[model samples]
Target: MSMFLITCSSSFAQKNELKELEKLVKRNNTTETAALLSTVEKMLPQATDDQKAAYYFFKTKNLINLANSGVDFNENRSKAIESINHLIKFENETKSKKYTTEVTALKNTLLAELVDEAIDSNRNKDYKKSSRLFEQAYNLNATDTVYLYYAASDAVNAKDFDYAESKFKDLIKLKYNGESQTYVATSQTTGKVESFGFDRKARDLAVKSGTHTKAETIFSKSAKPDIYNNLTHILLNKQNYSEAENYALTAYNLDKDNVNSLLNVLFLYYNTNRLDRFEEHAKKGIERFPQNEILLYNLAIINMQNNQNEQAKEYLSKILLLNKNHFDALKSLGNIELQKDADITNKINALPNTTTSNKKRNDLMQEKRLVYTTTLDYYKKAQAINPKDESLNELITQIQDFLKNN
Candidate 1:
């Protein structure tokens, strides 16, 4: 009877249920596939926990198959998530090598699918959804610096800067000395083009190690301009203006034309109230880009602060010639004219008995009228360029009224 039963079981009609499931899944007959998977799940209680966990993994594979078939993917994803969680739980409870390995493989596969989904979401500009998927991928494999870096980038685009910073910190923390060089190379090759990956690593390590003094010594030995720029920014943020200035000067010496370092030096001077140094650097910036409207404007502001009205006017006139709609320069010119009018009014008041000066006052008034008319024309042109500036419109109205009344 035993021999006869073995022979009957060997026939194709009594084949293994799991093998039958494979055939059904291959045929894309989801209904039959689901039914077979459920039957296998039912057989788990009588089998070892490893067998039960293996059945759950098969269920996860079926879920992935459904996900790939373009049929109710959300439901398929949920099913896969549930099965993988159960597999993880069982493997942990039983400490079974077979179950653990299978679960790990399934987790990795799921994570890869999630990463692909994130790429699709990003392509569609669904950044929030993409970030969620990237977070899922990171949770599955925290050691994957590539995934972590991408997640951090997505967070940054979403304006979650704090979270992005934290993610970057996590990646940097993963670097052991032996692996640091490799990590730096991989970060450069695979990370965002604009990101400072290894420098970020070194910075975080320096902070955590509380050996920034040592790190600074080592960094100074190399004297990289980029490193100096980063350190300068940090020092500036900490309100260490002197140290910041030193770093900025060091970087400027390395690359004289570096805009960031130059700006940093100017900022240091401005914050430290070193007006002389500010003026010096402002002159240097102007000399470097003689035609730059911004540099010219900055020079005019410095002159204005020094009570050098004629010099300020000269720079302001140059700016207005280059950019006629320079609102700041126009306003400054108006203020200067008002100051001149105040001084002339004081002189006229002091000479009350000089009736012969009436002719001179009349000529001066005509000159003021011509200047006001020219200013009104400039304001009109500025209004045309920037219609959204209500202040400009108001100034135009005031000038028109003043011209009519005077």
Candidate 2:
């Protein structure tokens, strides 16, 4: 196949050629603008400062216009950024100030456009697309760390765990305290939506104008705690317990009251058999969240693990007081009472051979019967909560049989 190249036939020595490029750029004709810019770049070494400035600026302008027009998606975004850099370089080299305001505003406008699109994509539940868009926006402007946070959050929503982990790690490395402005369109408001960068005067004017109201700055809370907790969750899901625990500890240190992080710490310690650590935080969690049923249940479990049945029973009892239908607590209390039956049976077995002490054996058997009866009552409560549970039903039947035989 033969290829045809369309170059600006008019020489750069002619002003007509520059005007033609400008016309093509304004018309959003990327194909022809790029073709002419390619030819102009070859002449840059000998071109006048003004000619060179015009060339680079219009190149950026053309690409940006194409991006705005949606003629090309990813390609134009990168190309526009690249060309804008070249234009900025030319301005600095020539000590010229032309197009400075336009370049700065357009660059910001491009990033804002990307952010808006990402929000739209996320609103529509296209999390994967939202992640990619926010990622592109962040890459285009790394200073906007909140966009990176949004990208990571979207990746999590998409279940792209590894990618989300990497993005979150980057935020951690930056010590990014995620901050962003939350604009609420109140019933009473003022100012143009695009009018950002509010100072005292601007804010006052905005309020007076009655179309814009700046919501409170979201600076009090750092994004790092959330970031660390998110990392912990991802690590836990991947079964990387050590790393998960480390991240959870970091989050806990950052904010001791972070429930997810604190709970993760408890879970990591408990599941890894670090009962001491589990009990320590579990108690602290209970101190903070007195009415938290899950923490109470877990505390009871930790006590049970250490054979502190009385303490375990106390914790479970509190849960029952708060929520009578707490099935887990009911089941756990039933199981603990069953353990009492086992203890009494052990006592009866250890009694000297019945021939040597029939009376002691009889007393032990009487005590065992009483314990079994209590076990039946506890299990019956559990049965009321879940009658179909096979284990509970079987235990109840065994207790009934023992009572009958005794």
Candidate 3:
């Protein structure tokens, strides 16, 4: 009899608390709603199924109100999600559509609010806050995995490596390639082509209404290679060379047509002292991007290291044709000329002390001076592009003295 009385009192208290919660939620009184929500959650297990349903529904509503009121935003947003999820499950189990629809609508509103705030924060350059908001948005709607991707990117920009690592791994697990098709049409009213951005139905409707023409679908490029490349960059920063190389290779394999991806892998290999792979990727990158200055420059350096000066010169000349003020290429050409002058001087010094040899030595000395003069011209051009280079100033002075003396 005592147990029954205790149950009845608890039930009466739950009813009164729920009524107060409903009134507070309707009034948008976030502070009292938050305090009462805690009281209601504790009484939930003892409440009837219908009472439990009411508790969850009101809980979700009150928490959303708290979130909008800016009182413990992150905590309220998370708790609101939990309440909504429980409400959905309970509605499903009872085979009723009582509160699920309203809860879903409320959740969508929260998701939109979070996403808009996240975009605004990102625009403000508050990357850490943006990342967290995007993550919360993703949690509210797991089907929208793009939010997770954005969260990871913002986390990387914020230098939150641990969060970025976890989110990137989640994306990889989900196989998020980020490829999609866009719809476009030419507007009949304006006589201009318009992009609908994945809204095919809207584009079709525009065409059907005789307000547009040329409805088309355009497939976007896959983003997997870029994702893996970012992961590789993070790992490289952490000095985890083996894992970095693995991810870089994954990026390379996924990037069949992306020159930037190829370049990233080439850099990774080059920095890791894997010269063979670096040369291999550099040549492959050149094949795809023949006019790419960086690829051409990298190949030139490789050839120079291999004692192939003429081939290196050919690459450097190509770079200059593509971009006239290529400072590094010009500087390299100057160094090659200096090397030729050194070789000529060595031969002249080794010549025998005789009349014919004396004449040969004089001729070689003139040739050396001519080569040295060419080097000076190259250095001067390079200096014109980068006048603040200290090394170039010293070399130019030394070359001027050498030309004057011999």
Winning candidate number (TM-score): 3
lDDT of each: 0.68, 0.80, 0.86
Q: For model 2, how does the per-residue alpha-carbon lDDT over 1-406 read when each residue is reduced to its tens digit? A: 1222212333434356678898998888888988888877877766667777888788888878787778776788878877776777778887987777888787788888889999999999999899988988877777777889999999999999999999999998888986545433333533434333424465556567875565333234778889999899898888899788778899999988777778889878877889788878877898898888887887788789889999999999999999998888888887887676677677777777758688888877888787778777778887888899998899889889978887
**Cα error, candidate 3, residue 152 (Å):** 2.5
Question: What would the per-residue lDDT of candidate 1 be over residues 269-329, giving only the tens digit for each residue?
Answer: 8778898898798778867766677667766776677788898999889998898888777
Error of 1 at 299 (Å): 4.4
Q: Candidate 2's C-alpha lDDT?
A: 0.80
List ranges where model 3 is wrong by over 4 Å: 1-5, 78-86, 93-96, 124-128, 156-162, 192-199, 271-274, 299-314, 331-406
Q: Best candidate per lDDT, number?
A: 3
**Which residue window of length 10 is worst by lDDT in model 3?**
255-264
Work out candidate 1's RMSD over C-alphas: 13.0
How large is the C-alpha RMSD of every model relative to the true structure? Answer: 13.0, 7.5, 4.9
lDDT of model 2 at residue 275?
77
The parts of candidate 1 lying over 4 Å away from their true place are: 1-256, 291-364
